[model samples]
Target chain A: MECSVARTLDVIGERWSLLIVRDAFYGVRRFDDFRADLGIARNVLADRLGSLVARGVLERRQYEARPPRYEYVLTPKGRELLPVLLTMMRWGDRWEADDDAAPVTLTHTTCEHETTPVVTCAHCAQELSWGELRTDPIRVRIPAR
Target chain B: MECSVARTLDVIGERWSLLIVRDAFYGVRRFDDFRADLGIARNVLADRLGSLVARGVLERRQYEARPPRYEYVLTPKGRELLPVLLTMMRWGDRWEADDDAAPVTLTHTTCEHETTPVVTCAHCAQELSWGELRTDPIRVRIPAR
Candidate 1:
């Protein structure tokens, strides 16, 4: 895929893949815990976890050696997806959920204040809405596939 | 179902659905233009467009009466997803693209500075890392279906 957004979607666009990542963010590690929280089929969960690990978005660590228990943990690359998930949650709270029924409120521990995330310019730190930003793309002509 | 991320994903999580949205953002409105850019099958594109219009993410407008031409435009609800797309694109440019080969560069029009997006705390304006945030979610016990 020539487009960066499409490439990103290829990795984690599915509902299940994202939900798995969400669970991992909330400290769900063991397979059983993921299953418990997600109510996901065992085979499907295994498949998604395996793919995430292969893509380096997650890692499998042997937490117990007696019976060889392995737990999934987000890798550095996986942690970079935080903003994507945060923005998605904010969109849902505003659009889908009933008024005053936001399922979660995020608190910034560094600031000791409750906050939502705002996407801002990396250089100037101005908050970016759709109209404020313009893309000057280096257009690579991807052959129509 | 109780999770907002999952709920938002329910609306636009599929790869094709998102790609269609991406095309819309890039000013692709007519069906033929979207099909040309994405090379998506006609049936699939039509189905996704219909669903988006039904969900109020997109609205259809008739531009020509003689030949009956219609175009799809993002609604305000849909435009609000700008942050999510920005974050996703940034992540992809960093992780998926070859180093220094970013497909697009975004400019903050007001600042006249080219920048990438940074996710920040809405309250304190500090840049957010995954570790800096804590969630106090109102956990609604959803029955595992």
Candidate 2:
């Protein structure tokens, strides 16, 4: 549980939380739109939204003053999650999809082409495959409580 | 829900499922090791393991026959999830970790250097940032039921 991955899961590990982030990436901002797009119960959606905002992944912004209406927008931290979602989508498209085209394609605006994302080493810039990577245990300098 | 991300979530969406996969990457193969490391309910661990196997993420192998002992190993499909897990861990290390060093470091075996993974477009090989990509809806031909 002390692992970074475990800590990450502690924040946005639940199905509904990740799905909410996915919906936000799709430009879903309104409560009704999120509920309709996800078919999630109102209470569940509200709770997840609250947690995401509290966790600093989503920020609540007021879009209307008279009705006191607001929308949830992805924070920088939440926006950084695109790689995680995109990688999962790539895996699903490769392994889980039926014998049909992917339901959505990601276009790299910089390159003007549809793209599949691959993980690369930041230092060497070599594309990583499963066999090319290994984990080394590092001593975590735990602070005195 | 028809999107690949949704489908991927349907398979490994649960927190425990992904955690179990994470542990497998860290070389926790035995059921007891997983139970101890995760501190998860026995029934929940068993259920998630069963689902992962059924979903082709993990393969069960009999390591001992006398008492019918088995271990779960990641299949090729499961190994491909390294990017997803690595990306999440990187996010957590960057944003969620306390004032401590990362608990583990990934090394690229080919280059013999510590690695931070970045998502890169397979076509152009450019590292993707949040604003550099956009999703476009693609028609998936639904199979006749």
Maximum-lDDT candidate = 1
| Whole-model lDDT values for every prediction | 0.86, 0.85
Report the lDDT tens digits of candidate 2 across residue range A26-137: 6788888888778899999999999999999999999999989999999999999988998998998988987766467888999999999999999888888867877677
Docking category for candidate 1? Answer: medium
Candidate 1 lDDT by residue in tens digits, B1-145: 7778988998999878888887777777889888888999999999999999998999999999998999999999988888989999999988898665647888888998998899899888889987777788634233234
Mind giving the per-residue lDDT tens digits that candidate 1 earns over A109-131? 99999998999988888899777
Off by over 4 Å in 1: A138-145, B138-145
Give the TM-score of candidate 1 (chain A): 0.90
Worst 10 residues of 2 chain B by lDDT: B136-145
Clashing pairs in 1: none
| TM-scores of all predicted structures | 0.92, 0.91
The superposed Cα distance between candidate 1 and the true structure at residue A145, in angstroms, equals 21
